[model samples]
Target: MQISQQDVHQALERGEFVPHFQPIIRLRTGQLYGFEMLARWAHPELGLIFPGDFIEQAERDGWISELTYQLLRKGLKEIAPLPGEPTLSVNISPPQLHGTSFVDQVHEAAAEANFPLNRLILEITESALAEDIVSVSKTVQSLKIAGCRLALDDFGTGYSSLLHLQSLPFDELKVDRSFVSSMTQKHDSRQIVAAVVGLGQSLSLTTVAEGVETEEQAEILLWLGCELGQGWLYGKPVPAEQLDEMMKRRQPHASNAILNGMTGRQSATALEIPPMQRFAQLRAIYDGAPVGLAFLDREMRYLSINRRLAAINGSPMEEHLGRTVAEMIPEFFPTVRPLIERALAGEVVAGVELTKPTQNPKELRTILLSYEPAFDESGEVIGVSVVLLDITPIKRAEEAQRESEAHFRHMIELIPQIPWIIDPEGRALDVSQRWLELTGVNDDQWRGFAWLDSLHPDDRQPTIDAMHRSFQSGEPIDIYYRVRRSKDHPWQLLRSRGSARRDDNGEIMCWYGSLEIIGESDAGKK
Candidate 1:
């Protein structure tokens, strides 16, 4: 539904409007990077509304400038408390740019919040500028001179061309999310990415691929020479609290996971960003390559590596290239040395999972690796192409799963009463056969769907609703409901206590609860 200007003004007056931030990554380094400020509205009545819904209406009603001002003002104030100065990209509407004093207002907002002008990236779309080149150019120049970086957002889908590129004084180009989103499935999309990267380089401007959704696409963009990227592949738009926590964490796992999700279904090509002349030639031939290739000098210093190789190494090409293995990462020497030595000895090493430590403790304590020798034309060993795969998170996840299982069993065994774990849907994940034996129910009747059938029909709805509320609100829950042994038996009280598991963003991922027979204890007290 379209929101009226009065609604927009009222929401603004009531302080319902706010900015949501999405991260922008330095394609090479998987670090806690910059953010883009996206507008959001939390209407008292509408509940939650996206910027697309009301922003244009506000713009059309001559309140676009005020909205833009509010967004920038809010964005700067929120970022003021962050540990380090973070780059913030704020969207600029066409109307806001038309005013002669808009640039000055931007300066005023930055000064008001004591924010650094250099940290602000004013993102304007190509379509927005297409209609009035003269005014847009003036606005762009004004923003640039004020030390605010200008970015041409959504470059490919609109009126994008060499002329627009030449006329606009933008320091960055955000390749549209549409192209980045489809890069995995569409061959034409990949071609478009390659073209944009090439154009960005020739223009001497930083190219940021938006909507990078997969490890494969990130690898391809790096190979195609893109320097930066932003998307769900990197991270979804988050609130100030989440973004601050991410910065505090100083890692981008969630962001990277988002990026990986974008390209999960597409075939990934390994990037060859290494300077090695030989590896460069090999990269042209390897389509949808599975193996990671890298070239090291005599001292085992990395000279060049492909995107696959970099992913194997734990970063993007820009961050990995031009640095020695020891310089980029010294801990790898422990596991990497033996393999390098083997390659130097004219032997090909294979299938070995070498563990290398990362300087950052948050980065898995160690990295796993494998490698092969890069032989010269004379078949003489030169350098080793080290292939690193980060199995740390996976390994930790497995370990956590095992520990959870052990803990679950211990909790079940320790409790004298029948114990069971149930999910949000009130379906049992684990249940003790003791409860089944007490009720004379077969093991088959106690698992999964059958277990839910045991809940007394009169009490089931309330219990299920309580569990759903817990899952939705992320609140601790305890419910006492009745379970029937059979149609002939009286129902017994079952008390369940549970909590929700959420991701870093505070979204509920799953809910787990444990049930205990409370009837006996209540009877003893009575």
Candidate 2:
């Protein structure tokens, strides 16, 4: 029988939504790292409902947050009784990452369960990163402050995955199951897995391969320097009641005893090459970076610099070595020296803007400076690694945009008709001063659907219908409306025309329109 949405809602209240565990094993050591908790519906009439059947439905019905908290509570209660600090990973839906209560609720659940936050892992999918990234970032920071770990689930599936990896404080990068499962047969899949592992190694992140079902896959992942695996080969996701027995059955012998068919010491030694390869890749990335990269010694002399940085300094890369910043780029030196000094003092710095004059007298160049403290083996601050991004273009673009907007507003004041702009969804983006003056209101009051409030009551419905038709047809709309400056002023007939602002592809980017008074209203004649 197909279940109605109500059935799932009731199931949640009845506490039918529970967590199941899947083991994540350390590939190199063959030791159990943790258990990833998955949600299952323990329905009385139905045997068990997997997350696939109801996860999206819960999100759509606006209960994903509650469902997630329920799972966390149930899973924590079940896992608290287990031995050791084995991690418990739970998937966080996109909705749960937003709003105010998510972090507080999780803190409440963990506190009530008496589970250590360090061993709790919250897995987030790449898609979640796209929605309110600021919220996601704040959530990550808060969870980290609480000593909880975060995993980027299904890595490499999204376009901005790499950017997220750079920006967010993620503890784990999960290799998507599709790549892990296809590694043995598809060369591209295997390469992708290797690249992800290599990337994780470079970033010092624990890389986990999902859906590893065969020995060959594990072998390849281990060779690629990926140390964690999760899938059927380790064990299917099982109920918490069955966990203790499984743990006992799978406990490592002789402290993670060597797996069969491999010389343990040799296998461990062979894993060394990937790190060297990873370092080489990291170096290549550093050298070819779009921004300027350099290392400044304690004395503020250039220890190393990339070609891009050299180009920015108007000097050769090799020539930059052993020269003080003051000697190399006299103009840039004074501005950046203080930031480098801070890093040399063991303080990391970022986003310190440095502005200098370019060769052209009229132009100024701006670079965003970020510095990392380099440390020696003895734990002393050795030098500073500096990253300089020339953001002059972005700054210039922003300035030019501001000037353009000012110019547009000036032109709008000079025009006889009131001008307006709206997004494709009909949300008012901008309206001219004329409209605001005529309506005896501010533009803020007319944003979104509220713009209809300014129209004469009878004309509002007709205007909406006309806009709908125009949007649907992607055509110009010519319509009439009635409005007055105030209740004391007689209503006047106005002509409004709006047309789609199309791009090169003929896709509507927004709607631009103008309104003008054509005649006095019927009420004024009366």
Candidate 3:
């Protein structure tokens, strides 16, 4: 049963409604970066009810704005005692934001708490402002004018264009957690997140990704160039008291000091090597290594460069060292900036292909680059180590193969009938360009599974079984099948042949097969 507005009010009077704090972290740095305040209701009989259960109900009863105000006051009261006073992000309902006196209430709340308005982060969803943006824009602007932080929450999953985003005047962008969680596994999600992050960076806005739960997700986000992030992987929501306790337990043991040109946090007087010797050793390994290597400060400037990497930059090692990547390779700046920024924020980037400028005037070399955080032994990341491996030959070979395939495609396009190719596994390996052109199907989307879409249900299994045998036994096999082209068109008959190819080890590697159109009009009518 839903509680009444009066009942909710009574509960609030008795100090039942409160805020729960969830920690957000910078992926590269393990420090407590920020906190998102979640609303919670501690019921006497029901134990505890999360916002998911009661927040909308309160809104229906027209008491959510009042509840939110009370929670904000409670949140600030708890945050004030913290040592560093980390940024506090709170979710704001669109109704509340658009309500009259909303700006006044927020200002009065901050003034009463004597809190820094800049540290208060207000988050709002795109859906909430979908109805009327004019009023919403004014409301948000007024908040920002009052010296409060503004964030466009739940970015993506909306039709709102860049025009809406620009009009919001948001200072931070909280990428929808769905995109952040799925980015590592899906290309579409990765592209979407990358685009959003790019938009944020171009506007000089801080981008925070939510729902980061694993190291892989964190690594991908870092590689994609996101800055601040929050998720269960960092820390789940907790009470203010619990947050304080957790901080105390995890705080560093020492304040960290610098001694003899090295950041010193370890004990003095044992197995000490000269700083110059250490630097020299690092530089020596870097110079002689077959793989390219370089050092970068937090801002992604080349702190040191080795001969191999310098060759990739088309300059002397000394000349390229100490330069920003944007300066050395301006063309790659847009694509690589996020990575450098993520590394600067304390995240490792591995297995990313970076196109580098080479000494050959017109050539570009693709290299696999990995960047790891570098510390001065004080556990604070001061710079990064970059390793680059040339993969130009591999890339060139792949391109040549693609070009040859394109030529074969052109040849197939000239044929009168649809043609197709399949591997031994009965999966579509390739299809004639004419078949795709006539069917209005994308050639790139013609993956193994898609070929099934073209076959008659009755003939599909038989065709597949025969192809499997041909591949497994290294024999030439032929079969007849009826293929469905379109719902309005009759099933067309076809003759398919399969031939197997084996590697030097005599293990079957692939099946080369073709489907040739055959009908009553054709002589090969079998």
Candidate 4:
């Protein structure tokens, strides 16, 4: 059914176009990261109307830009003074993004709402990139320059998603719900979601899964390394007033129930079941869990082991059963014995990282272990439940990163001048040791646009504007500024030059630059 253009315009005029907010959760910590504002039409006669009911009509009528601006302004204003001041994400259609004045309108709305531009995220659907890529890219760049983050919504649904990702500057990618909802039922869907999560991680983008409705879906998403999630399981989109109440009452661990496999509320229900049925349910959960799980007797012998734990031990389930730590893996038995004793004594032993000798002698594996005591009806500890997580890959990644940083530091220290690196967005990534020594600033002081604080007060804004322009244009930078040698000293003039470091695809990865001391009078000459 098609809606008349006049109806949408009339609704807009009556202030009926409002925003409903759905929370986006960070899966790693299960905390509220932000919210996505969805447009809703609170019609008097027709009851509440969704965006789908009128958005297409509004777009065809050439008033989608106006509708978007209204929604953006309302959403920002409602969320700006939120208790924690969480980030607000507002959607924009392709037409709006392609419009000549869209970026200006966004800035104006943000200003009117007294919202910080950096705390706002503008989301464009993947399908919107089907046409006018160049125009959309220009608008996106301008919005980023004004300090609003960009997110590609419903990312995997588009035909040219890879192309859009390559050409655009998206800080976040929201995986479409079609894949997330079917992941458990379809093997191929699971693979696709995993791949998208991996792709986002590689590109340094936050990956969010949308339309999650079940704990199972959320658990799978967490296992796939997706950073954030949105769906009914977290909460349905509600009006600003209800959302405010929800935010205030939301507990940090509320959304993490799936991460722990079940919540206390669910556990209470489980206790009401018949003993046989409860055991069956528990067995199913244990077998299906992604991490290693084992049940140990007071004597520290394995009574039951899940497939994951068996695989990690490089042994079959039968072999692990009735075997003590010393009998199975003698090399690390001394280290494991104390942890088992502690758990049996009703104390939780967690976050213990153990380097154990695997079946392959040449390779040592890193494993993280946690133990929880199981209690009887009398409240006496009967046994222990052990969770073992293989963290070899994570440890290896950390080691490799340290080595890479050390190598880069050595190379930078060799240079006599102060060097720095900034990402494509002009946020500082690293600075040379000479920079810290000369400015009398610590490493923390030089990270993420904080390097600007080291500059003389008068030269800061001009330098920032010049760098922003250079970043947008991919041009070489040559500027002179004054820097303080120390807190007690006067400012000294310095010249800095930088060039864009492009990838094989000719996209700017970062800006590499160095600073050299010039004559004190050089600042005046410039």
Candidate 5:
């Protein structure tokens, strides 16, 4: 049945469109990780209506944006008070995401609510990937910069899902309910789920299974190495109040079990064991930890060093034992002494990035050093625990990113013409120095769609429409527009032309354009 615009608008006015949150659980220990906010209409006569029943009509009637904004505000308000750092995932349609005001709206909502942007996850359907990917990628990058995570919802359901996964910066990949619901009974579904989990693992993304309604399905997902899950087995989408109750009822042990599993340990059991046995277990866990670990005495001599720490220092465990950091790394002793003294004074210092010279003087490694004071039963500082993490790759990546940005800025500044780069969403990511100077606008004013503010009011809409057309069609854009140089100066007619920059796979990455003064064209006279 078709829903009228009046009905939808009335529902909005009545505040009937609300968020129903479904629990997303950790598959390993069945702990509640977060909730995916699903939209539902609390209809007066027709009873509760799901998005499937009216979302298309809402979109057709131009009410989808309002609906999404309402849901976002409602979801954030509802989830803000929840305990245990639960994230709220809200679904975003392509049209809403592509709008110029979308990011601003999100930022405003988050700021108004004082919500932690990192705990908010915006989920986009895989089908949305079929839209102008360049715009989507840019929007994704902006969202990430704002500290909100993105998820590819219903992943593997669309034809270009893989491309979306590869091109976008999605932090999570949600396996489609179709695959999760049937994986237990269907061999093909099982294979698809396994493949998706494997792909997520390879990409270092969190994998979530949807529509897991049975223990068997959940078990299969766990066995397949899926990290998270959501379905009826966990709970149906419930109202905020009910969700609060459910959260209260959730067992703390479940979270503990999940954390232990994450640390490669089974559910911890209470046992009456000798102190020596307990010490051995702790030593084993510490030695096997992924990071380099070492224990030093009050005098800053190495009492024990794990193999990982030894390797990071370019030495063996035996050589590190009973030796001061100066003896092991004399070159770095000057830098290490202060941190050791601070740690010995019961101050825990961490995340100190420093250069560590290896045996090969030509090769210097960047490492992050952290020191924690160890205490005895009498509450006296006995020693310091040192952790060394090799960060050479991270440092190199940062340096490369800096160089790329510098080079891009240099090229743009050298160009005489007013040049700009826009993402598929028509948001300006880069504007040349000439363009900024011509408009007398600062960097902040020239970013995103703010460049439109410098355009003649009469020409802004047409230019935007033309850019949208070019983005959708992946064609070159050639448009003439009047831009304001200053308050005293008249609008200057300028012609701008740009084309899509595509990757090897023919996907649009960005649009580059340059503007030139048109010098009183016949059309400008009009």
Candidate 6:
């Protein structure tokens, strides 16, 4: 039998949504790490309805947030009280990250369930992260700040780049199941899996190999350095009741069984944590690349260098040690000499700005350069330890975001109808100049609930009621309200329509609306 959208809607109203837990395993020890909670509909007539059928439709119908919240609540209910405080990974939708009050709703949901935020892992897709990364990144950062971890799902499936990984924070990297299922049969897929694992190791991200259906795939992934695996080989997704029993029966594979569900935030912000403590793992994986590391003698001659720094400086690692910094790159030596001098003088210099050569010579790479004075056992200065993390993409992303915001504001101003924005609570956030010009009020006078005072006496109460109804129902507001052009002028009929901007949890974060004079060609012209 075919299922209609209405069937799905009714299922949600009757509280039919439930969480199905899939096992994620720690590869090295064959121990269970955590479960990824997937959403399912327990239809009275149709049995468990999977998300692939209804999730997109829900989002299209503007009710995905409701679905997300219900699943989150049900999932939290199932696991929050379990022993060992097992980590739970939940997939977050794109719309929730883009405009919905996802950040606030998540914190609220976890708090309501008395769940620990650190044990929560939010899995985001690469495609979603690529869409409007600037806005999504801010929302993601807020989640990170709240102690929630993030995982980048479907590692090689979308248009993700090394830059995307560096700019947006992620705690775990999942090699998409397609690669794992095909790795043994396809050479390219195996190489991709190996590369992703290396990327994860370099960035201190816990790599989880997905869709490992066979022992051979698991062994190959483990050999490729992936620490986690999730698929039928471990166990298929089951109801929470079964999961609870499994959790109780299973002991940690090793005394130090890897809890790979969550890891620390991996981003430039990680730099704020003590350099040595933060970079210790990074230094150990010096061969993995991403960051450039090197050591120079007191005379500024290269003593040791990693392959990445050698490639970056357009020189071989062996040649780097024999040649002095000036001899290797005379162009950059002048700018770096001062910072090097400071390190040699026993001063630890950090965040020293430096430029690097990119493929496009016109566009130089931005480097967050740090230099620390290396010391001997006797406390005498030996050399300078250098760490160069390229941040050019991050800088370029910021510039692009600024330009996009300017364009958005310009577009908002150009529309004929008067545009305005409001907080979820109905307080004015922005009232376009057009509204002010027509009303003969300054921007300050037009903002906040004070604008309600200018409504025609008879329309004020009705307008307030309409706003409340819309805010309460998460529906669009549309009404013919009357407002005076001036205190002395007669009331003019206006058509206003606004809708709630919801986060993934069905919580309103803000409202966007526009106003038009009923008879006038343009609100501003009138």
User: What is the descending lDDT order?
Assistant: 2, 4, 5, 6, 3, 1
After aligning candidate 4 to the native by TM-score, how far in Å is the CA of 54 from where it should be? 0.8
| Candidate 2, lDDT over the whole model | 0.84
Judge candidate 5 at residue 468 and give its lDDT. 87
Q: Against the correct fold, how does model 1 do in TM-score?
A: 0.49
Minimum summed lDDT over a 10-residue window in model 5 is located at 264-273
**Candidate with maximal lDDT:** 2
Give the C-alpha lDDT of model 3.
0.75
* Candidate 2 regions with alpha-carbon error over 4 angstroms: 251-526
lDDT of 6: 0.80
Off by over 4 Å in 3: 251-526
Computed on alpha carbons, the lDDT of every model, listed in order, comes to 0.72, 0.84, 0.75, 0.83, 0.82, 0.80
lDDT of 5 at 506: 92
Which residue pairs show backbone clashes in model 2?
A: none
Pairwise lDDT winner, candidates 1 and 5 = 5
TM-score of each: 0.49, 0.51, 0.50, 0.50, 0.49, 0.49
Q: Which stretches of candidate 6 lie over 4 Å from their true place?
A: 1-5, 251-526
RMSD of 2: 27.7
lDDT, candidate 5, 427-503, per-residue tens: 89987777776777987997888989988778899999998898888889999888756766666788999989999
Report the Cα lDDT for residue 514, model 3: 65
Predicted candidate 6 versus true structure: per-residue lDDT over 1-526, tens digit per residue: 4557787678878989888998787776666677899988888877877889777887677778888898888888788987767789999888888764788788888999999999899999987887799989888999999999999999888885676789988999999999899887776787789899888887889899888888668767765668788888777888877876877666543212222342223221332344346467766687576788999998999877898888778888889985789999899999999999999989999998777778887888888889999964224577999998878889899999999988987887898888878887778998877777677777688678978876767778888898899888888989887776775565667899988888998788899999988853223223
The residue-by-residue lDDT of candidate 1 on 1-526, one tens digit each, is 7777678778778878888888887665565557899988877877778977877777778877877788788889888767657788888888777757789789889999999999898888877887788887887888888899988888887765567888878888888888887777776787788788777776777888888888777776765668778877767898766876767655643323325445422212222233355355666754246656677777877677767767655688778666777766565556567677887777777666555556765554434555677654224566776665556677789989999988987777777666566655656666776677556678777766576566666666877788788766778888887665555565677787777767898766555656677663223211
Q: How close to the true structure is residue 48 of candidate 3, measured as C-alpha lDDT?
A: 77
